[model samples]
Target chain A: MTDPVVKATALRKCYGDLCAVDGVDFEIGRGECFGLLGPNGAGKTTTVKMLTCALPVTGGDLTVEGLSVKEDPRAIKYLLGVCPQEVNLDPDFSVVKNLVVYSRYYDIPRAEAEKRAAELIARFHLHDKLERPVEDLSGGMKKRLLLARALINRPRLLVLDEPTTGLDPQSRRQIWQEVRDMKKNGLTTLLTTHYIEEAELLCDRLVIMDNGRIIEQGTPRQLIEKHLPGGGNLEDVFLKLTGKHLRDE
Target chain B: MNNSLAGSLSYRAWYMWRRNVDVSLVTWKTNVLPPLLEPVLYILAFGFGLGAYVQQISYAGRAWDYLAFMAPGMVAVGVMFHSVFDTMYGAFVRLRYQKTFDALITTPLSPEDILAGEILSGATKGLFAGAAILLVVTLFGLAQYPSSLLILPLSALAGLLFASFGLYFAALAPYIDNLNLPVFLFINPMFLFSGTFFPLDGLPAWVRLLAELLPLTHLVNITRAATLGLLSPSLGWDLLYLVLLTPAVAWLAIAKMKARLIK
Candidate 1:
């Protein structure tokens, strides 16, 4: 794609002798939702961590908006937002305060942060729970608040690592809808998940990773059609390529 | 990855400090009580009760009331306890249980910023506790004016010193329980033997020499000197020690935390 929002070329991460992400390559165009589908220990989170500048890259090149991850991580962070896999909301902060405090990390001014926080609160349907501490919020509310906080900086690229990993169906659907809306608003997103349906619904193009490498990369339909000529879903393609053995064993 | 020492820190560190202050403000009621009451309780039990029986202790080359002698040391201890405990228990909770540092790393904040902020916040906590105890002592007529005013700023410096010391240990601690080792082994000894409750004059030479090595002893020396309006040229060594030690410890703390946080 011309002027991709994110580009990874032979990206690698190693911990001593154990290489977590073994030279993967992909590109995400602006406003497109890209997915990294994998089982546990598949290096999806490791790749996401590198993209978000949480971990140093061991080898190869990765860039966000033409800024190298190694050379300008701080500058790249200013242009991106990340929703981590874990529920790490500040337990001490109220729903509104959480957004406002996160905004400060981006050097967003107080007045503008408050204004944007108000808008996000209303949009996420958290206006009524503005004063409620994050610990008091339901799991779904917390997830929504995390999404809202990620958008507080008006990021050009949004990274969601298992955004709906443990949500109820209704909450999961709500998050999916919000993500779709973000895409329609032209926000480029890189998402990682093991859920087949979540990937099928959200990703415009995708990659399936296993054992530190991307085994397949294509649109959801193309991947399924290529793997199963006789009509089958993406899950069948995933199982066919990655096998049925439980990764955790 | 900008792993160099200077590149790891930036003005963004203040944001982390601001976040802690926000949390502290929310818990102000509970946070304010310990500093305010600890001195009074100590004075009532030790100063009034114990001092009633003991004769005036000779310190700074003159006879002084036991309460007067002990009061400034309480301020020093307050600085140490507040700064150390906040960075140790409070920062460890944020680092491990809360995963606050993980979230912060995704933002513009480098790991050093988070550690710097914790140290600064801990020092601020130290200042708060020290100032509270100072107020209590002043009300009891224990603090002398002018020179006593210096204690407010000195508390922050002492706070920075102890906070860095605490964060370094926090970074080394494998689990929250491991933090108890420092408290039991180091903090408790410093609290009792840092010339806080009594003069170091009659102690063994080795014990006095060891006390001179503990950061708290110097803090207490300067604080007691200031509170009694007895500042002397000898206190320059104490001031120099704190000044030189704080940044070294703070840099080491930040480096240790960076190694732990950054993979």
Candidate 2:
């Protein structure tokens, strides 16, 4: 097999006395939709941060596109797009300007950036909101804009951290559709979400994590059958594996 | 430059600076007017209002009208305030509230590049404000010597110096309210005691000693001397101090900001 788009061997991240991601191993193939399913503080965000080079990896071997993150992070950044849990949009910019300014960070030329931005704006159904300030857009529109901004670099790996946490059902489905379309176009995606339905619908292969450890890994159907013999959706399997404790505290 | 420093800074910083200009231009009416008007207001209140009572003063080894002496000082003060406010409050908004810094970091830009871009943007604001004051003073016939034009670059350097200081404060500030401490305690006192409104030579020895320790004092000295066509040997030291202090403070700002930004 061609090398997985992402490969992590005993991947780990630690914060002082606390270990966020501990001894997890995974490989994500090209064009496959991989999900890291976990409750809050389950090291999902930390794993994504390490993968995107936003946070340094404390230990273990991790590589994206066959490039070592520790040796040349800039090269790795070029190949990955991240949609953070927070909106983090530049409110000072207009909808189109946000995309354009983001495109510039990758050193895309003005003419090409404009063309690419126009394509993305149209694809994301943001044509009408082009001239509007980012603050004026709804939460869903902000999420869509964030997705488009992530695509500006035309990355090889797309990492989404709770992409639909706050969105309404319609918006969430719309984003799901977008992710499905991107997957059909052969884009590799690594998504982290607590919503088992989102993981079941979007992830081709997934790992259920709790407290920095991956307890199970399989196809959604296999996980549902293996964990819940009665056979239920991912939410049942998720509860079976991760428990229904109140994680908010 | 070592590989680490070289890696930290890049031409990508220009994109960060351009981002600021794009947003500032959208609200130019609110953003541009204050900086342009502030020095003129100072000139009116102090240069004309107070100069009427004060006689011509001998400063920098030459005699000039009080307005002339005060104009350069006002320009320096304008640069200082512009850079500090632009970087401190503006950067805090981007870092904490807007989360723009988080967005930028995801891109190919490094933390150092972001910090450098912020410093450049702050310095550019200072330069524009200083230039506006220079133009207003020149139009009023207060700035006599053509050599005063050198104040433009000097102001830019001072902007970098003050912006680095602002970023240092920003990196350490835990909450937005913590920012008020520096403005009230450090910046305001620096403004009053940095030989801007009056000559430091006339102040007490200890006070003068404290003034010399302030960055604005060196900037003011450079601006006043450069504007009055009074280049002296000590001017080199002033330039050298700002030149050396900028990168040192920037290095500190970058390290602190990295720790705060990168988890």
The candidate scoring highest on lDDT is 1
Clashing pairs in 2: none
What is the per-residue lDDT of model 2 for residues B77-157, given as tens digits with 9 covering 90 to 100? Answer: 899999998889899989999998988877888877888999999999999888988888788876657678889888888
The Cα error of candidate 1 at residue A174, in Å, is 0.6
Model 2, runs deviating above 4 Å? B1-3, B61-63
Per-candidate TM-score against the hidden true structure = 0.98, 0.97
Q: Per-residue lDDT for A1-249 in model 2, tens only?
A: 377999988889998978899988999999999999988878888888888777888889789988877776777888888898899988878888999888999999999999988999999999777888889999999999999999999999999989998999999999999999999999999999978899999999999888998889999999988877886799988887777887862
TM-score of model 2 relative to the true fold? 0.97
lDDT of 2 at B120: 93
Alpha-carbon shift of residue B219 in model 1 (angstroms): 0.1
Off by over 4 Å in 1: none
